[model samples]
Target chain A: MELREMSRLLYQIKLADQRVATSFERETGFSLTRYEMLMIVNDKGVCSQSEIQQEMKIDNAAITRHLKILEEKGHVQRERNVANNREVFVRLTETAARELQHCEQNHDQTNHLIAKVLSESEMQQLSALLQKLNTI
Target chain B: MELREMSRLLYQIKLADQRVATSFERETGFSLTRYEMLMIVNDKGVCSQSEIQQEMKIDNAAITRHLKILEEKGHVQRERNVANNREVFVRLTETAARELQHCEQNHDQTNHLIAKVLSESEMQQLSALLQKLNTI
Candidate 1:
């Protein structure tokens, strides 16, 4: 692969990410990081705070701080796990689910726009390549 | 473009970005943001502050802040344009050029690794697709 092309690809990906995050924040008043946290919870149905922190690659303090904001905004709730008192589980509120769904449309549209240039087979190849990179 | 697959592609891109950034930071003691700023300056030769900030899609404040740290670290130099005293131009220092070239090996290796799974034709197609997305 051309190194310059690869660099440009990364740059474009970052630009798209920022644009989508900006739009999502404008519409929902929730930061992209917060939305990502909610997505992890939605995917897990109910996940622990540590799980979210680990998946998001953020520190405990940052996760805690964001969770508090999410809690205050009625987007999520945390409960201490009975089995492990130290573990705090997080789940999205219904309002969060609805908001997430709304933000998801913007995400979907951006993804769709990004993919509009490629054929189905090309998309498959691209996906396989990205998967390989991700695994690496 | 399968929407789910597209979403996964974005997720993978993010993971790879974080991985690369973390590695680069560990090796160079420079944040990815700082490296990006240097790249922009290198590309432009001698670019105005507003130009780099606009191309990077970062706010003036954020760009200024990073430039300050980069200047402190001897990675860049900002000078007032002779023709227009109000305009500030940024250019990479010799130290930054050396550092950037050293770090480019990591970037090249990462791109090489990412492309290893794809055939030459696939790489071309992928490159073409990414270029199209960038334009969009």
Candidate 2:
């Protein structure tokens, strides 16, 4: 790809991000980071900081900051593991579960936008390409 | 595609963005917004608040904040155009010109990453697909 194409691709990615961030705030009063943390915690059932860090592949400092945001938002609670004093297990609050449910129910519109933008085959192609990139 | 697939796609986009943002920050000690604003001003060859807003497709408030940051950083300057009493033209400082030259000389690694990750056909197809999406 030429430099111009690279710039446009990056710009498109930014626009997509803005769409999601705006959608989350308008739909659930949650920031994208808060929604992501909730989703990950829910997916894992129960997880620690290390697992979250690995799954997100973000810096620990960024994780710490987002966790603080989540805590302040009352979407998550941290429990100190008695067996491992230094380990903090992150668990979603019931409030988060309710919000996630709402998000899921409202997600159809968002998904429709994406699917309408890219065909099923194209999305699969994009995913395959991205996953390959991730591994490398 | 399912909602899950769309979410994953969006997440991948965020990962790409995070990588780009981190690299841009490290290279120029400037935020993505700052760098982008500088690029726009230079490309326009004549810049004003109204022009920046129209070209960048951002709200006036956002442009104001970014220009303020750029101004404070001493990378940009604005003065009344004299021809238009109510309008001001923004100009890049010598420092900004030098930095842009440096950024151009050091091609963004993210560019190479994109090219390496996507097949040539895939890149062209994705760009066309994204352009269609932007229209909607």
For each candidate, the DockQ is 0.37, 0.35
Off by over 4 Å in 2: A1-5, A69-74, A109-111, A132-136, B24-32, B69-75, B93-111, B132-136
Predicted candidate 1 versus true structure: per-residue lDDT over B1-136, tens digit per residue: 4333454555555565565456545655666566667787898899999998888777899988888888898888889999999999899999889877776665654345545555566656655655554554
Q: In TM-score terms, which candidate is top?
A: 2
Q: Single out the weakest 10-residue window by summed lDDT for candidate 1 chain A.
A: A1-10
Model 2 residue B111 lDDT score: 57
Question: What lDDT does each candidate get?
Answer: 0.69, 0.71
Chain B TM (all candidates):
0.66, 0.75
| Residue B35 error, candidate 1, Å | 3.5
Best by lDDT: 2
Query: Which lDDT tens digits does candidate 2 get at residues A14-93?
Result: 66567655654565556656567678998987789889999888789888889888889888899888889888899998
Docking category of candidate 2: acceptable
> What does the lDDT read for residue A41 in candidate 2?
93
DockQ of 1: 0.37
**Residue runs of model 1 more than 4 Å from their true location after superposition:** A1-9, A24-32, A53-61, A98-126, B1-9, B27-30, B98-127
